[model samples]
Target chain A: MGIQNKYYGWRWGEEDPIFKNLGYIQNVLGYIDPADKSFTSNNFKELFYPGDFDLLQKSWKKYKKGTDHAFEMSYRFKHKDGSWRWIKESGLANVFNTSNNPIGGIGTIQEVTDKKKKYTQLKSILKNVSIIILRLRQDSNNQITVDHISKEALKYWNIPCETLLKDEGYLRNLAHKDDLVGIRSALSNSFAKMEFFECRWRVVSKEGNINWCQGVGTPLKDKDGTCFLDIVITDITKEKLYTEQLKVSEEKYHSLFQHSPQPSWVYDLETLAFLNVNSAAISKYGYSKDEFMGMTLADIRPECELENLEIQVQKTRENYLNFFDGYFKHINKQGEILTVHLYSSPITYNGQKCRQIIAIDISEKMKYLKFIENQNKSLKRIGWMQSHELRAPLVRLMGLINLLTDQDSIGKEERHYINTEIINSANEMDIMTKNIAQIINDAQLKEKMNDVQIIAG
Target chain B: MTYRLLQVDDDPVILFLHNKLFSKYTNSKIEQFKNGRLALDYILIDNGPDISYLLLLDINMPVMNGWEFMDEICNHGLENSTSVIILTSSADCTDLDKSKSFANIVHFIQKPLTKEKIEKLPLLMEYLALQD
Candidate 1:
């Protein structure tokens, strides 16, 4: 075993009695040589040992001359139990005397097994915490750095934590190009105000896919007012897309409502007033928006038609039917009576009874019916003339020709002349009948032609 | 003795042809009235021969048409006892339908009276005889 001597408050010879009383030191197997008076009794034996004696001597000689030379060494020592025990030996060299420069040193040796065990336990705890804790640091130049990050962060980024921490530009490069400027500005503003900021932006992951991230950041400012941002990011792409889709759907419904060609209206069932009316309904009914809003079905229809309209409303309320069509007299803004064909259906508006109606005018159809009646009257007159007056004259002409041809018992020359006269009169009667027939035919043809034109028109 | 037959029509040619044809064909005196009003007056006043005389009626005549004259005679109940036939060149269904409304309308014949159609006139005589 090695021993170290340390000097205390007394001179070296004055401590000789104390050293002599220590039998463990006097019975030592090793002795010091006087030729090298620089050597100490404790260090001499350690230096003469075979393994590290030269190194120890060289170190002692090199440091012995310093005004303050205190040294400590730990090594294995042989114990009485025939086993090696770890020990620490410490000594302070005496450098108080100027003339008698070489004195003894005093030291103590102790075992440290319990302290080593505690230190190992503390080191294990530190390693565990290092794997879970994350710390970020930034310089005064706004260069961000990550000190310690959990392994989970490395897996999530699909890159080594060291790579990400070493280069601040690597994290900036992940930000979407379009959002980089705004994100940087927001971060700067947040730090300047020493406030928290939250924003959503696109980022490129290590896998090269664009991801939407909602980042909430707080400024960590130092006493000098310099700040760094610590941000937490969460994925919110699906929710953002759903919100955009909802907006598009609302716009589509609005377009359909505004631009549909059919005249459509929603009416309040209780008040019988129009709740909503499209442009087509306004133009068709010749009513302003205010006028239509104030009027009810009974006000628009004739008094006699109100009962039928009420029945339709009752049926709609009962849910007996969804659609119906009927004819009603409509008065325009000018008070002109119009025959209108109406189609109505039940609908719900804001959880209230409502109906939609479409109307068409049919006044021209009634006019055509009256015109047809007149045409029938004229045709009857023509038929009466053909059957009665024209037949009478033709009947007489046929009788006359029959009589003239039936004549007998007359002189040949006189018969010839009379027969010639009779034949001439008969031919003239035939020509007259033919002209009358032609006139009737022409009148009938004209009537038919007029009828065709009316139908085509 | 010949029975006098009065023919009324607005057309002059139709009137002349009627006078000549009836005079040569039948042993009856035929008189021509150009308008329905004149014919109605003559038939009302004359009532000639005390043997019913046939009144050939033309529907489209000036002053008084056939329908008006017939209506007048009917209102007076004169058409019920007189022998009358509606002679016209119209083949309209409306005129035919109107003929049914008048009891005095004995027969309806078309215009341009041919010999074959005239030969069938004995059917009118047969109807008159049946009435007698």
Candidate 2:
């Protein structure tokens, strides 16, 4: 898309909704009066910062000469509300379309106040930038001698500017001993290679504080054919400290992602492409890193589980706080299906909207639950045998005992037969009791197997 | 177009079976190799771009296995013109899924091919008709 099409997609008029609400107006450049229809550079200057206006003039000249395609600059501008607003202004000179002569320039102005606010806060630190500019001369012995120092050196090092003017070795002595070798080698290499030199080193101040400093230098020769280095030194202690802290925090975050017990990954919200995956995720899903990159989240899902995934994705988009924890079937590279429960959270990964998920494989848990259900059925069967089987045998023994009599009038043969039957009934009862006891013992052994404890390190 | 059948397998039995079976079809030449490296050299460099051959690839070999050979042929821009049908004993579904990534792979089949199984392949039938 061309720049003009992007910026001018909406025709500027009072009828346009955005322009009507924001009270946007456009004018031609170099016109004398604000009320005139023709644009004026003077009025444009009123809406821009001095640095931005200078950039516009330079870029505009280059565009007119066909050396540059477009001119773009962003800076603080006075808004309709009488407040300073940061805005970007872009221009393209001579937009050719069947024209013999050069056409007038076209441009766009947009409000970037929100993004500029962050830069403004940081800009406060640079209000009085104490950059110490210096010039150095190199002798034939490959020795560097400081020739001049800017007046700002006094404010930073607390030594008079003339002290550097008199003593050439004063600057080298101020640098920390540990940082000297690296800094000197970098400077010499840049000189020999005819490349720009930049390095950071620590400098010991007069107040006994060590400050991080950066030097950016360029090598040049004067009219007398003598080599010199023009360099800029800046105190960057706060920036260095902030960078170190940020690196440590990022390292801790990455380690946790890698060492977590569950398989985890981060995927783009729109495309569902995996942006990052942990080692556990790679091994569990049975895919190499390259294969994962080429696949979407849908590829791992079983066909039956895709509907639920679609619904969950919609709910997440509606509100990232609307979390989901549900079991879904996933297919591995080998076509073996696994059940997993995902704990997902919306995250911004590398500035793109994405989701981070910790997937817990629940296949083994499902198997364990099924095993317990089967065990319950066996226990019910054992209970039935203990209650019904013992009851029937006891009733038969009672009936047989009732038929025998204690009176002396009974026949001797009848009494002998009754005694024989009583012995037989007693033996049958003994066998049934032993069988019930054996069943109970077997049940106890099965229960003991469940006592095995699992420990994870 | 006349077709050439190139079989790469470490097992001597399978290689002999592939050569004996494929050579039965008229107007087609069958070449067998014990490993992927020799087949790759024949296809890409030895014959260059002038001659195109159908491949019977095996997953495991002594050197430069089938996967590495597939990667090489694709990188050399010979994948589109060449036809590959993996004939291996492995029934791994992972290999079937991975074959979709290559441009030339037409079929993934189990090994110990019989006369009936060979006739069932549509690509093989088309090539058989186009022989000479």
* Winning model by lDDT: 2
> Residue by residue across A282-392, what tens digits does model 1's lDDT show?
776688879888888776776677887888777777773478787778766766677877788777677886887766666666656656665676566555554554454
All candidates: TM-score: 0.36, 0.42
Error of 2 at A325 (Å): 3.9
Weakest ten-residue segment in model 1 chain A by summed lDDT: A21-30
Off by over 4 Å in 1: A1-263, A346-353, A368-457, B1-132
Q: Candidate 1: deviation at residue A395, Å?
A: 5.8
Q: Estimate, for each residue in A24-50, the C-alpha lDDT of model 2 and write its tens digit.
A: 433111223457543333354566655
For candidate 1, write residues B1-132 as lDDT tens digits: 224456777866456445444443554455678787897788778664454656777777889988888888887667645666777766566777898888767778765444465568884444323332
Q: For each candidate, C-alpha RMSD in Å?
A: 21.4, 36.5
Model 2 compared with the native: what TM-score?
A: 0.42
